[model samples]
Target: MRPTFLPSLIVLAALLLCGCDAPVDHYPPNELYSLVVSTREMVSTQVAADDTTAVVEAWFGTPVQPRWPADQMSGSAAKALVRLDNLERAAGRVYADQDDLHFGLYNEHCVTCHGVSGGGNGPASLLQNPYPRDFRAGVFKWKSTARNARPTRDDLIKILQHGAAGSAMPTFRLIPEQDLEALVDYVIFLSVRGQFERELISGAVQELEYDEARPSDGLSLMSIVGGDEESEALSFARETLDRITDGWARADDAVIQVPPETVADAASIQRGREWFHSPKALCSGCHGQDGDHPLALQTNYDDWTTEFTSRIGITPSDREAVRPFRSAGALRPRIIVPRKLSDGVFRGGDDPQTVYRRLVTGIDGTPMPAVNVSDQPSATGLTSDQIWDIVHYVRSLGESE
Candidate 1:
């Protein structure tokens, strides 16, 4: 049976009202969601007159525009914009029709926390201990690929299917597969669009002319606004977009090639337990003696938490620009608590192969790092065979569950 309203949902509904005492049946008018592009302009002083802009130009190029009656934009940038528009259209249809069940399913029930822009600062995001992921940054923690590589489509779908344990992210196994597919596509669209927005700001800083007079304001988006420079910017943007898209496209090809599972004999499990405490694998460093390791410090942070805290007050001096409402007592940043792994469900994925990748790639943005595997026999570093043994041992913990 479908679940009734949940406590989290109630909190979300209150946030949606923004302190307004609105009736439950009062659904806000459905609005077409669009990317909230950053408006901060780049100063010429930030970019030297002869600075190498190939990187920025490649990634951010020209702003997205419409065809003919619309402004000019890079082909790739336009594609991203188009994809987002298409998704917005689809989501809007469901929202407008008041198909709350299907609409919630359509979005993986994420809009409440992720916001329509996919920015981490969703309305309800602030209420959650760890904010909902901001897709714009394009830095995913649970991925099998290299630290910098985009996550595979399957990587994303798996999270949707199983959800991230110990977090608000919930498994949508009951949702229709087609709905999940649409949600994934929409997420990717937001990510691409968000990345493009970042690049565009960076490109403007590097590629535009700097007038010393307006030191703080930097270059207006209109500066160096036409001719070959614009064309070059657009070309660069398209190339960069293609590269980013291609990375996601090729992620499946980069999966770690694991050998088939081996026999889980007592000896192999024992060996794994030994390796777990070894200096190299260092599983006990965080997982503790029996999986419940006491933290060295009271606060432990993951990548997102680290980034969010570091940028407070410093990145954008205007506090209002980042956070809108807050009491003085709430200003102190909250710290992320690392999971007690003894519980046995890996947040990334539960399968052996997924665990193997986690060992190799490390969870991005957290203290967890990729383990170095060497074929040579040593007191430190592990061989592929040794790593597999550890995997078996770890799985054994789950058997009790």
Candidate 2:
């Protein structure tokens, strides 16, 4: 207050120039600043060492490059690797871990029908006619080569891409190429691991059989043996296990050749329908006239149940109280009719081909009989083209429904 305005201004300017009482120095620095600096330094170091060869070496711990023959990658391997990369990128985009790839695919596409453990016991599986594949059994129906044989890798890929013609398996073409490839790899892993476990079980069984066959000349051997029936059963089980293991180990390379989509023709449907109504087939007896009757052949449930129960040793009351009920309704006498094409309840789930498969293969541990209209009376006890006709007729019913 005592100084003049010019002198005070000059003094303030000097303080600012000297960085005394400056606004920039008034506050404390952010704690995160140090972290940011450290992160930048680490990233710089990583970038300095980063390269394709380095990445490969870090992952595999080997200097070996992919063996691309003729200086070109094979179609299968190329496709597979591309799919893998695509999946990895997708995982990053979604902020998902590597394990999430398996979890996502399994929960979204597989577990809905195949069950959590691939046991084919998912809740939706009950509504499906042919049911989902039981991975535990390691049995695949469709293949590139023949019946009961392992499908080729290409065959599996084709099925994944195109899907089965007459089933609930929808085509997954919308999936990214990389995810598809990863899915295939995971499936292969499951199959390989399953096969290995099957082999191990078989080997164990064989060893038990061999031990049982060993001559028991001493008290020690006698002590090792159990009761007669138990010992004999253990030996037999072991032998069977060994035989199965050997067979699985020697299995041939299962590679499926992709055929044109036209391979699955409509002729099968036509054949399936004709077989459904044949006198010898007796499907009409249960399914009804023209497959439109309300009760599917107007089956008298009370009488049928009585006869069935008599033969099976299960009381009517016991059958009625069974869990996860299969009966259509809770009427006095339960009418478990053969599923018809026209029923409002679509048990087959929009797949006429699956219905055809169910017709031919039949459901395991169920009353449904396997009807193959293709075989001779003596051979398969069916006529040629009969199954195909039945399939065709069933497909036709879809329009009416």
Candidate 3:
């Protein structure tokens, strides 16, 4: 059965029933983790992280007052990704604008758990097992995009319309379409901003130096990143802002290629069963032979929990080390328990096509891996037809249970 996460729903329902007001003030600026400070092994000083913060604020602005350089990025670069007006409407307090148009849609629907910074650290952040997604990481658990590619706009909208069944994320299908579009815009905006911040953080630890005298150089680096042009020195972060926006603009092309589904007959399922236990696919490694693994055997950390915990000497299972982070706003870390497929409770939709996407792309920020598939009948990886058989087997396991 899917997790109810009733406490969170109760809290949200109570607040809405009591007419709790959402904040309209300045956004809580995103920042570096305190765990990094404790590590002391960081190459960038506190000053550099501060500088990066300023650069991010300059480009994105505060939650109450949102903006981007529309003039700087003419043509389809910036505006094509998301409108500033939509962002303004999506952010800040839950109130109407001067024209009486609705604003703060995100505040009304998202801020309680997503946090003002979209870091998934609001009061209710730690109340769930998998935890609300930290949009800052720019990694989504469900999507049709290729690995490391930004999700298509449709992907975000679908998640909003049909919330994850086993998690705290709820469906907003009853909400107005315009409001839903605004929320989608806000999600993309946060993902873009957060990815840039993370890139600089990585840059600081790897390439940058903490200069006491020249503090403004970080802004200069951002000039190339957010300035429509960037150098190759920073591979991932190189042109990060441009790359992110452009990536979103071109996400339609990034979808994984899916072929015609093979018939799901008994013979196909038997073949799939063989592949399930085989070392090549190895589905039993985590989910178990019956596809009903117990939580005791499943211990995997998500990208957000692993950000600090995956350090050379640290891990989420270490309670003492993460205590400071938890006290400071980071949620209590939990293992990403594998799903009991035999129970027929797929977190992402269980439709054949959706399952095909899951197997092809894998879930982002989790231990699930993409199965290798090729068009040709190659010996190295499973073909599209072969994968469909595996899908049939997976679905049959649920029925047998």
Best by lDDT: 3
Ranking by lDDT: 3, 1, 2
Deviation (Å) of 155 in candidate 1: 1.7
Q: What lDDT would each prediction earn against the true structure?
A: 0.57, 0.41, 0.73
Candidate 2: how large is its RMSD? 21.5
The per-prediction CA RMSD against the true structure, in angstroms, equals: 10.1, 21.5, 8.4
lDDT of 1 by residue, 22-139 (tens): 2122111111111111122323322321222233233223112101101334344334433443353324323334654354333337766776456655456766755677777688
Model 3 off-target regions past 4 Å?
Answer: 1-24, 32-41, 71-78, 96-101, 204-208, 211-238, 294-299, 375-380
TM-score of candidate 1 to 2 decimals: 0.69
Query: Model 1, which residues run further than 4 Å from truth?
Result: 1-90, 96-108, 207-230, 294-300, 308-333, 398-401
Q: Clashes in model 3: which pairs? A: none
TM-score between model 3 and native: 0.84
Instruction: Superpose all Cα atoms of candidate 3 onto the true structure and report the RMSD in Å to 1 decimal.
Output: 8.4
Model 1 residue pairs with clashes: 43-218, 44-210, 288-293, 303-365
Per-residue lDDT over 300-369 for candidate 3, one digit per residue giving the tens place of the 0 to 100 score: 7777777777653576778898776676567777777778888887777778888888888888888788
